[model samples]
Target: MEQRESGGMKILFTGGSSFTGYWFCRQLLEKGHEVIGLLTQKRENYEGIRKERVERLSCEMELIEESPFGSEKMIDLLKKGTFDVLCHHGAYLKDYKSEQFDWLYALETNTKNIKQVIHLAKEQGLGAIILTGSIFEQNEGIGNVPLRAFSPYGLSKGLTFEVFRYYAQLYNIPLGKFVIPNPFGMLEEKRFTFYLISQWKRGNIPAVQTPHYVRDNIPCDLLAGCYGRFVEKVFVQKGPFYRSNPSCFVESQGAFALRLSREVSKRSALSCPVELKEQKSYAEPLVRVNAEPAIFEVQEWSEERFWDDYVAYALEHY
Candidate 1:
């Protein structure tokens, strides 16, 4: 890898406007790294959460719009790349929670320029290719007796990594896999956390359907902080291949909902309530969580500050 400045490295970042992606970009910037966000969607589609993320991040860094993963445009950018690293955080997320996800299409789209991109990484002297992974994918992380993939999307993610890792090996370049567990925070999606907060705001009691299944839920900033440190470690150490599973809150869905309720109620005026259903669905894994933790630790994290930020975001958006 070639050295440019004395301080931080420049990264070609994808998925900067996504919920997690947005947080990751902010964390990277806080660590003094330069983030050149390559957006997958157009300005018109950058509405709601994406729009908010784009608007805020645009003020902080450079953003190139409408660049899909493994596309001709992205490859062209890589061809002229002067980045220290490539952070591939964007994945095909349409219907990602469904069972009918097209793994083949996603796989093909994710690695269309696999060979060329790896070649470029070597030729351009990029430090490493960091691929964002998922803990729900089969054989990833710890826990989950069998550790089977949660859905077709998980399968697709696992497969995508396999192909990317294969090429990285072939090119003899450094590659790192940063596996993500469930991340929640301010400006996040209307997921379990948001759903519960919404119910509390409307004086409704929310029910957690998959209450019994154990999973990992983490704070977004904490995870991003860990990632920021991970990027630094990548250049410092020799990484033919490496992976980091950043784990935090591990508990049942029902317990997690109640936990959120407690945090929100203590911090805000809203009274939150939750109900844990008799989980009858065994479609997903019963116990699936991450293995590694130190790879993504944010040294400055404070639980109190996290809730403060979380409540502030909720008050504004919700």
Candidate 2:
């Protein structure tokens, strides 16, 4: 049954301070739903957004003021107000494996803390629980690949999805898992865009990596629209909606094909399948550019002027 978007949906969002969460909240607001955001603190940035929207910084929504981590105080907060939806979109993604502290931090934010929030929401009988997942979840480990590094961030996401799946079944709660691929666009803060542009400016990113191996780079606003579709599909579409090329065939062993498209394209050519040529690994990237209506079409990133185009996009948006 298609779940109609009811009026006045009360949503409790955790990790309102991050990039993904920021975009998610903007989408929610655009849908005309009432949202209470929980962030780490009332910093200058938060205050600015809050001033724009009175509800953005309400004490009821701002649980981070009392407790730094939402996992720690989720139960008590739920008891105060019955939320229609709970979104666990907070995560730590630093690009270093040797950093033991980063690993532990990722664990706390992704795994343990999420468990706490899920438990509390389940006990409270929330309408739906959505957890943000990543493409790295499909890989074996984090940041281990030579050209592509999954990082501790990816590992944490993998475990988080597993836990969410297990607990969703255990509690018999309606759940939506967004297996998001690489998302890029100008939204909320352009820190990530700035970082990419900076790398391009400094020639820090290699030419081989300039065009990105994956064509799944989506604009932030467009991504938000996709999230809205997923939310609509939570009850409409059967099971969890894989936020990827649903038509792309995968091996029975869950290894996706990488040779869907050709080696070169006037448009963007993803390294998705090219890089995996040497590894002979079970998991291979597939490009389904067969002209059929794919579940998801990779947005073509201009290869020749990728950096220039990317920088232009960021600057224009900023």
Q: Which candidate gets the maximum lDDT versus the true structure?
A: 1
Cα lDDT of model 1 by residue, 1-318, tens digit: 644566888898988888989998998898788889888877668888889889999999988878887777787887776678889898888888988988888888777778887787778787788999998788898775677888889999999899988988898777899999999998798888888888788899888899998888988988988888887787668579888888888888888888888899898888887888898988887888886654246666887899998987886787
C-alpha lDDT values of all predictions: 0.84, 0.50
What residue pairs clash in candidate 2, if any at all? 143-150, 143-151, 213-271, 213-272, 257-285, 257-286, 258-285, 258-286, 260-287
Candidate 1 Cα outliers beyond 4 Å, as residue runs: 294-296
Model 2 lDDT per residue over 1-318, tens place: 223367546777766666556667777776766777665555544544333332443432433443344545656687676776767776665553343436566766665655566677767666677777665544422232442324555656777667777877776667787655544544444343445444434445412222222334444555565565555455344453333221222222112122212211122322322222232343333321111112343233233343345435544543
Which ten contiguous residues of candidate 1 have the minimum total lDDT? 291-300
Q: Give the TM-score comparing model 1 with the true structure, all chains together.
A: 0.96
Q: Candidate 2 overall Cα lDDT vs. reference? A: 0.50
